[model samples]
Target: MDNNFLPISREDMQKRGWDQLDFLFVSGDAYVDHPSFGPAVICRLLEKYGYKVGIIAQPDWRSTEDFKKLGKPRLGVLVSAGNMDSMLNKFTAAKKYRSKDNYSPGGKPGRRPDRATIVYCNRIRELWKNIPLIIGGVEASLRRFAHYDYWSDEVRRSILIDSRADLLIYGMGERQIKEIAAQLAAGLDVRHIRDVQGTCYCADNLDHLWDYVQVPSYEEVIASKEAFAEAFKLQYLEQDPIRGKTVVQRHGDVFVVQNPPVMPLTTAEMDEIYDLPYQRTYHPVYEKEGGVPAIQEVKFSIVSHRGCFGGCSFCAIVSHQGRIIQSRSHESILREAKLLTRLPDFKGYIHDVGGPTANFRTPACRFQTERGACKGRHCLGSNPCSNLTVDHTDYLSLLRALRSLPGVKKVFIRSGLRYDYLLAAKDDEFLREICEHHVSGQLKVAPEHVSSKVTRLMGKSGKEVYVKFMEAYRRVNQQLGKEQYLVPYFMSSHPGAGLKEAVELAEFLRDIHYHPEQVQDFIPTPGSLSTAMYYSGINPLTGEKVYVAKDQHEKKLQRALMQYRDPKNYDLVYEALVKANRQDLIGYGPKCLIKPRLEQDRPEVSRKQRRLPVSRRRSAKRQRANKR
Candidate 1:
């Protein structure tokens, strides 16, 4: 066993000559001591600050026995549902159980319970009633408010209230956890520690809370859709760290008070966090079960920055990481890259070097550091902000230095690149360089949808911008004599996307001679503007009523249209075309999407095909070849 890893067993704690640990972490994920894993980062950061910490990963939640393995800690017990929300990890967009758990040993399923954080906390309370409980990470952070639950198809109370934890930390949690540990060490009562930023606590009265804006009560939001939309809008706008005010909401007799977000980490602070000594792999105990599968994707990857200003409505990046970008210095990243090269199994390639958005190496503009992100406006959405700073000089320099590393063969930018932001740059050097160096034959980008109305609702650039980006990509690849293809990711059944909009996307795919292998159906997870729209049928930002496809059949039809060429999707695609009154697209014309099914013998070619012009038949033949 590596002594560098934090103690996971009582024997390991004994080996460290520790009688009691300062903190014990409970997590839903298998213990992988990598920076990408939230539990590992928090535990390692605590260790670096002179606190003895231990972790219990994926404990059996059915009984209190597993929770007793690490015993009670001296200071507090930090809990998280791993790197992802447990509900999202356990189920798919269709609410079906996933076959495998990437964060578990042997890629097995059912290693953790449904609501892992609540379950783990309950088990811990069974053994030790008054242990200081802190819940952070993706599950608690996003569910720290009264929000909609897609799986239950109803509104649920805040996770902090349901889990009965003392403190709820949101965002990346480095700053919040450090402050929290210090206060606990200084002997502050957990219940009375209410002033920490980036945390949520339940209060009995409003006397202690100041400068706070109250949203709708939980009763009102559940009873009225309009009230729910209004509450979400207020919560969404005040997420800024600099100019944000404290937000309070009522839940029955108690009030949940959330302090303003923690200040963005400086370059030095970012450097210090990533510079901690991480084992960069799963614990050796899991080697027999083939190790944790999630580590494979990030073993050689590096996180260049955090947060995103491209406010896509369906995404939770702005809600969790906040919109302000906190980036590491080039020297810090290069140091990590050197560490990666020395790992025993490192093949020459560096998998990725990015975070939320790969190219966002700085704040959105000059004023963001001082004024914070505009209250209700996006830096790059339907319309780009005039003051948006679109520079890639620093990111390009970092990539160049990484490429010149001693043992690094190739460094890929696998993270999502905001093409609209890239296109907004004054120079094309970044695009040209990415085409020549970073791309690995296919560069995937998310256009989401092409319809103007749907794109507007999604807070994405319109079809024109995607087309402009595609053309520029083609031009750059041509100039560089590269054959790299651009793979655009599209989503279906999003709010405001009716069958008409779905067919428009299908037509665009048909015109471009592309057949998508997969299509993303929108899933309304918590803490996103799109989820509010999905629940209330109203866009929270705007008071307009939006069309939502709630029926499973409608969602299936919308998804099928994106892959209309598949034989299995023929029935759904045909039905969607008929319902949209687009039967003209069902004939033998050169521009038609699919062949019309015969009434008598559905498999036979119709007379429409025989009577077609030879040129049109050749065109149809070419189309068939392309689909193949």
Candidate 2:
């Protein structure tokens, strides 16, 4: 193997002067030696701790031949379904197969199968039945519990039970993987390794379990929607690392026990992980195939922090990365930026400097580090918490420092920026600085929907907050003599969004005279509160019933309303306006969403009007108007 990358083949292993590997990582994505890729991070971390690691990227699961090529590892095998969920990466919100997979070589499809973690593990088992198999990554972490699967439209068993792996690491696995490796190297049996934090393992019974919260069994959740909601609520509340307890759920005779999440890394720990010796690009083997397409966006980006406190229900960040923020020191980020300047393709532009939510450099409040995030309360929900700390001094300083670096012309904040948090800050320096230096031609923000009812269910601030932010943004841009615009992101067919609310959003867009180029239809991916609501027709946090657009046609109508100005969407928009009892909005007026159909084209027009000639119809209408 080249000293720059982990061994990929037996030949590479020979070149590395190694007879066998300590750990072999099998991923559903092409090998990209960058920190943004989860598999790469885990492999590099293991290698840093003195383990001989090799990667087998996107191995063929159709047969056992590819699984045996890596040979049996001395320690165990690590499996991941790449950076995204397998089903989500393969299919669209409409449940149609996508033409391409960005993570695959040359952006081609079918390189990885659906439910990749399960398939890969099955193939590995066929080759060696007794090897220790550990699964992690976004796919495994989000589906750790018995949760809703959008593609299957059913509540499924825990991934730990389904994959039949000895261990499943959830969340960020740096802390858990290092410990597991040490114990395994010490000759501990995989079956007996059940106490690691941030991991889940199956048990035959509860004989060794304690201080755990038992959720509804798999059968109960499958049998009843209320039970499913109850189970999701319990799982959601206990995700905190400080106050969280071990979560246990029953699947047939087997019990899947999940230990409390690993603590958020400190600044020093976060710096160490990002400072690993990464080649910072896709493996050379993929060069003939034009490289993995997913690297384009992240290749020049810097992850300044991890985790989010924005608390949007439709997002899975809180579920996977936890709400506690873990940020890298400014020195570490500068080092990475300096490295980017030396790359052969350096273009004097850093794509982004943010994570799940930018401008969140610290915990939501001072108490989150000592006590866990408060249960059942959001820091920046519709009503901001009184104790929430809204500050951007540190993030501003980092941006200023990066801008001052040599050969760096610009640094943008492309990640989701919580506008409500920005508006809440005591001073406007951060906002002013962003408007002056950070923003590109247009800034992208997520207002989601204008209706208060929908925003409330989304765990977002109301429309009034968005309106306030918009006004403030415009004022700041005018002061800076910049003409930047806001490209607000809107969603369609989310839970609690009926035709009435959809029409309201359409009207809001109409009044603004801005039509969105694209609309995001809600896809109920696993491990999100919105998906639970879509499955059970009830909000898990609160017991209130919510309206979900499950039928394909209704979803189409909702999506059309977001882009009502499109000529192709006229029919769907007209149907939605009538169904919403807002027919007044479909007329020849300045505020009308669509023009009235010609008399001859209107099937619903009265037969009397159709029977008269055009000239006579005008005369009759004038006579009737005079008489009235």
Candidate 3:
């Protein structure tokens, strides 16, 4: 199977002696056999378990001909809008057309249409009116419920409703997919297949369901911001797999019921999924016009784990991957690294050996797996939880093994490593290991902001934790006789951050003598808490007002402050300093973010200087000008 991708054409399907495929996997991305693609994983998993699956990658959505190429699937059709939301993949944050798509062959654009899941499914249903359509992946999963659409600037109904998908499998879908496949194989009707966890479906009535909580209807949430906030809070609370209950929200006459998320896979299960004979590269079909560009970064990488516990306010990991961390076993990881060394393109370097948060290799607490994550709090946010399980022994051991593998020169932790977790580790062995062996040059960590108000709103630890982490990182590198550095990543114009907080972050950057080359302006991607705030100007959790930086000018100013040392940011930074009433910072003081304009560059100063006698005017010149 390594020599071949899953059958993408009818001839290839016949070559495998298949009369018809058990499923036809339709994706908005070109066919890539790598495990990173959801279509590849689900299709390959189905094949591994003896269900014939064929793929139709990026079918022409305008008509039914391309979908007809694969013929109707025997069991069902699985649809995904590539690896990202279609709207996001096609448009920039500024809503301009993107000319290239890494997920497409040759980095081509317009291969897949907007709202791909809905478009693809509509075509499929037109060709085969009653074929079961199950939609999953980022687009379907994040839009499983009614969500705020930044692009449309309106609240949209559940994607399940929009795509008319019979069922939606959300989150990382290994467990849910396997279970759903078995039930469907047994000849279950899509309408009656409601008991599966980590799934959502719609119905006209909900009398048959049990242990369900009803949230605000779609009409109410769309009509009122208050109702939207209330509904989102309830959805956020019950996301844990262990303790969550089935939740139902009314949309007109239809009831969209979401079952509890699928339980996180154990180490062995994760190992099996990754171990499935993945070719670990894009299919050869894409070799002509240059292979898929996205595979370049990941072909040499390993996904060491799934899920995250950091639960940043701006991130949607809590909703998508859940807060309970699930890692692959150390031996499983070592085996994969050894395989990477065997690849034709093998270099000595392994790009990354981590996922989501690189440092999280286990659950945050003893009870997080059997029970669920705690309510209204996180494992590491604002402050470490008293009961938090802070250890890095397993991750450290895994890193050591990969580096020791023959022909392996280096293994880097390119994924985001939670700095607060590093600070909370009771023993410093793991921190020491990363500093001594793994860091390529400078370790990147996200403190997000220094202002406590802003950090709290970002669901980040206080500045003191970042301060301690920085000292420890420096000390470890210094003791090891290494000249490595730390690159602190910050976010600007978050929900609670006003001009004051922006200036506070700028001051922290000044204190550290660091200037980020680029700063991320918070984009309100669907399903994030920060997006909820962006849409409603209200924190859903406490129902308190939040200051949203929505004005384009303010967003630019906030972003400019992050890179204030850049000469191009002078005007925006000046605006921020003045607006925050920190005009004292706009001068030539050592702490000033930027030097004040020269006398001639300022109209007032130049006018005053010109009116004075030559001797007096010379005093207004830059002091060192004549000396130089």
Candidate 4:
């Protein structure tokens, strides 16, 4: 579990003849093998490029002593902090946001720095001093700002400055990583590596750096919430290593930084990366000794694709993967599946496939190195253009091929694949295949919010889109003769949502008789566009007008919406309605608190039993049933 106790040491590097190493990948969390994606994939890709890479997973990164164990490398280090789990304050906000909704004792689940990455970076800075530490991944990528910190409950600076890393590469690093390696291999110093796309590093003089991408400053965003909200389709500002500056931008904010991908993987190169021999275990060696469950116990999932054209604000995929959809070839997927089947505990099903917003196999439109086609940063944001290519043909073909492979029974799309994109498909064959084979009895979908205004602010489609998707889902299920239910995911207490909107949502739920078993209160993870809105009550990148549900009372009303079906919540709902002065919600309304209120009123009536009319008292049973 600890890097110090790791069997492999510097001596092992010497024994393996790995001198003048090409890459040193410092992983921030526990190591996972079988799924074989993320930083691990990048590591394998570097090996193919003839680089001797060392993977240090889950280092106790608190001190410099542990960092010195790993010998120095000729090339700069590759750092990835993984993705955000949850924001502490966002979780706290959820408690008040949905006071009626029962939550676990501790609070909403949130995440902090992975012990390995945090400790390793601190130590790496102490030991290596000036050596380059190129940081990437969701955790490191998003926290490049001085934003609200829920745990300590305050605003903090960028992780790059905190960790003291050299270069910060946001988004997918396949293309960027290759370019960084090639430049270093060709004897180009890290100081002159400004041309690389999807990368951010510090420089002494800001003007000299490739014209600083024109993104709104944090101060501007904090001042005008609306402008910040409307700025970028996705906003994640990383810290520049050289100048100690930050690379911040709005999703659709401005056209400042447009550095093209240095080496966007072609279909063939993607094939090569996925085809690498992956053990596919979180701890590959541990599985053999029964330290963990075998594949038969838990199915391994892999991502055949990344990115999405849909620019829904609630989603961070477009910001992370960009609007361009990149994919792994069918051949590569099949090979990996075959390898899974050959494993000792191989099951007849491929657990899941896809990433970011899965099913988005290619760009929404023809992507060019010259002028970009995706003006909105999300395909679903504004309408798709005439040139926009919405094709499920290749993706469907990949799905069918994987199912045809031996030892593959089911291939689930566990990741959130945009329903809008799936709905855009002209043919029903893919949907049919999915309904018949891919789905379990319960299917998961994220409709986020139902209110149009809230949906707009959250950067998601309104209730209508979700309704249409539901209809489509039913049609498919009926055609397949399968009894499946779509489990819809909804969010409460977002930046712009208030009590009125929450009550409206409750009414909407009442009308549809849709009572979700689980409701998520919004958690603002680092590097997300919405985080800015939640923190500053404004959009940082663009100076647009925006609303934020930051008040504690406002959050409570939103939480009340989720408990409409429970009678125990009557008093709670009644209080919320009374406080809001919304008498309309008092009786048989979505915000009705009559059940508990009536029960409470019963005790007082019991004390005055003799005052009740005999006839009225006899009919009390009938009255209760009718009211209920």
Candidate 5:
């Protein structure tokens, strides 16, 4: 048997002539043996450093047999709830069961339990009480502190507290994981790993928390919304690695201390991780069960960078990945594009080559790399920072390199772009190139909202930026003589979007003459500045009152306003219009979102009333009042 995959079974381990393993990696996903999967990267990194690692993926949590299949490792067990949070993977924003689990084999569901990290750790603790349990992933990283849990609808303690994990790594783990293995190999006690950067651990005393910045305690944040808001603001402020301090929150007698995030990876480090041998697809073992479905989107894609400094208030990037952007080398990306052409499924297309924000191939400016992203400000928000150096020359050259590959017919960038960043570029070279070759029919951009008030609440730029971007996109595509459309994504019911603001967004959509196929409802996920605002009726940073749509019915109205064309949303749209005192937008007029629910079907508007021209309806009402 080949060592193509890290041993998933004892037999595979024996094939490699190993009697013991250094780390037993457990994941909630089926073992795909690809770099796109975090576990694959960690295990491969360990293997490269001469650590014997074995992966037990999607193991049956009901018993300990699957957990012990490869036997306990000498060092510890690495646990992650796959690429996505288990709750998000299993449920929708509406708290409904998702029909399919894309990460599971054959699109199956229920392969892993809810809160898989906690469940897997419990099982490990029950079997081997002393074994080290390290937890990290989307769930653990984003939920690593006292924060909100939307599903449970409560202020939950850190995952380190609930999972009883020995160490919790946050953000990009490539640097942190290797440091961990080296320490463990050197016979350091796992509990003493509290000193490691980018990790959170539970300590029994307050001695180690001497230099840590203490936030509101668990009880304080849970009992009072004001306390929670204050705590979130402090938490948000101290997340940058360069300027961030150690944060400690008391959980009863114990303390959950989180060290500052790991420094962003260098170009060489990113290249090393990307250059490591990855099978590029799910293990051949999954070939019969239709293979892992998540691989289809990523097998041809390349992740060019790591973090986002955009600092969207509703996003959790600030809490987890940190604001510092760590990018891969152009050589590393070109090497991967060439590798994609060799795949049997190659159709001469490179699906995507980007990370969180595709256009962000470098630090916003040179100062960010040296001193770090500004702790007091955002790179892209209401206004681009003057210090922000926006250029697409490097990213443009990288795209050109990929497009020049021999078999590459097209190189499409499916990842979303930060339009503000694109607009800040010195020229339209990247813009023209994207419209001419990269765009596949329509380019999807996130304008989010048109109202400046709501956009500011969402920590987005002014509507004027979107207007400017739309004009530029059209101009570039027009110059290219292409008919590629720009599809702008909108979000409804975010903080500060009330009936009035929602109506304003509807008016903007009408003027644009575009009806969205699907609309997004602002989900208050853990660790986002928005979630704090959602739970507490105040903006954490500014201490200003913010309106949040919590009621299911009201949320539906806001969502329907965005997609008023759908027949199913007619009633909701009508109700929203009436609620906003916007009956003028309810008629058969060109600007109307929905026709006044027919006079016969509903008494909202009668035939004679409808026949009155929209321009004179108010005058007609005045005439009736005069006659009376």
Candidate 6:
């Protein structure tokens, strides 16, 4: 496989080479700083190792022309299985839109460019049938088996089969990708690269293989998309040969093999990766086509850490970044901050410096060597773990240090800081420092739901905990004479939040005068335990029955409670209050709640003539009584 198939920038080709190359990287995402997507970073890393590399980005490689334009390569890497579901959803959505009798009302579902990976992989196969086409990233990696497709609601086979990729690399790809590039650079052939950790390849013959293999029953997975997604989730476990857990898969005549797991990149590797000379300005390529970026101008979100220790059921950080909590040293974060400040468009404040559960520092517990096991590294299943080392003294120190640096006037911890964790700050002085310095007007925290049952399901901090913390926070702010506000992030229609619970939550919000600034509807992002629960109504972790409010009307009512003060939404809130069986909230909702319209006074004869429904008639009667 020659690397020249990729059409490189003419300037880059003239400058970097005597041009025959060892590798070509292709991705469906715009190349950005940090290695969120595998092929993008892998291409940069190959260049670092002195190999000629070309990138075919956001390509629609559906035809032989797309492949020829990409150029033939010694090795080909297809890195998309994009950030969302497989591509079939687009066709499904388009078909739905075209067939709609009415112009399909307001919300159109989003779809992934699924055929990107399929087209690219199939085209590469056409160009050189046996060339080593390594497919990885979320799309290919998770699809490396016969699994459920949520969009299509059907069982689908490995992308390696569909896209015809030579191998599938799953999980964190830095170490595995680096090793792959190094091997190719050293002229090692692809066949001999067997059992490489974090690598999956199709192969022949599993009959002769030893060791216990857990091949999930096709029927069990096909029972439902949720069932299949659950089985698939469990199947993608970390393997450390040194730790003695490796999975091997046999695919027809070819075998998909995995090496002992590679420890995810440490903080230093993350720093080096982030330090890549990326043209950080938002490339309005989508905007050029008159489309907006899914996220507009999040120029401030630089990752200071690569992973998280929190295993909240509602989160995918643990699965995607792993629970390792690898963090860049203070110097690296400061350097990035300084660079951002120095940018010609220099914004004074750095938005945030953290990853999942931002305030949670690495090595959550000091007890790392109990019987040579890290007690803190694995907190996914354990909630409010006793060993949680959430002290913010170090984080506070980091924030203060950044604030004190040259060219930096302020540094806000705008990223999520776990309220429960902050409440547990070992040092009150640090808490005070956070209140005084870290927060700019408002501090955000995810007290996901007000209900304790929902909190437990979400693996989130409870409402009472947040209440207690809020009281303490108010006192601290008052004592310091600072008018800082606590911005609570709430989620509606999560698992177990039935109408009754939703009503209870609405009333709770009313009582506290705590109408949240933002109410997030449960989105059910892929690969998270919550997504499984949302899809199946059962917790994948506990296998316990869970209640998820999937009804659109119920979700709207709960969200409307968060905006009870808006005059335009008053009637909606009142109706929601009635439905939630919390009519008490109509008069005594949030202190700022708007008043609803009252029915005009009418005589008995006129009321009889109106012939309203019993429910509406009762509501009108209640309105008349309230006026009296």
* Residues 125-152 of candidate 1: C-alpha lDDT, one tens digit per residue: 8898999999999999999889999999
Q: 318-374, model 2: which lDDT tens digit per residue? A: 888999999999999999999999988989999999999998999999999999899
Clashes found in each candidate (C-alpha, N, C closer than 3 A): 0, 0, 0, 47, 0, 29
For model 5, the superposed segments whose C-alpha errors exceed 4 Å read 1-3, 600-628
lDDT-superior candidate, 2 or 4 = 2
C-alpha positional error of residue 452 in candidate 2 after TM-score superposition, expressed in Å: 0.9
| lDDT of predicted model 4 | 0.61
- Give candidate 4 misplaced runs (Cα > 4 Å): 1-8, 18-22, 34-37, 85-119, 145-155, 207-212, 216-263, 284-299, 367-370, 382-388, 539-544, 567-570, 588-596, 600-615, 618-628
> Residue 549 error for model 5, in Å?
0.6
Overall lDDT per candidate, in order of appearance: 0.92, 0.92, 0.87, 0.61, 0.87, 0.61
The better candidate by lDDT, 2 or 5, is: 2
lDDT of candidate 2 at residue 627, scale 0 to 100: 100
Candidate 5: residue 339 Cα off by (Å): 1.0
Superior by lDDT: candidate 3 or candidate 6: 3
Which residue runs of candidate 6 sit more than 4 Å off their true CA positions? 1-11, 33-40, 61-64, 81-112, 141-148, 186-192, 207-215, 224-233, 236-244, 247-261, 282-301, 366-382, 516-518, 564-628
In TM-score terms, candidate 4 sits at 0.81
TM-score of each: 0.96, 0.96, 0.95, 0.81, 0.95, 0.80
- List where candidate 2 sits over 4 angstroms from the true fold: 1-3, 599-628
For model 5, where is the 10-residue window of minimal lDDT?
598-607
Which should have the higher TM-score, number 4 or number 6?
4
Model 3, C-alpha of 529: deviation from truth (Å)? 1.5
- For residues 477-555, what per-residue lDDT tens digits would candidate 4 score against the true structure? 9977899988878788887777677777777777667787766777666546677677666655454556777766656
- Compose the digit string of candidate 6's lDDT tens values, residues 91-158: 33212322211101121233224456776777677778877788777666555566445455456666
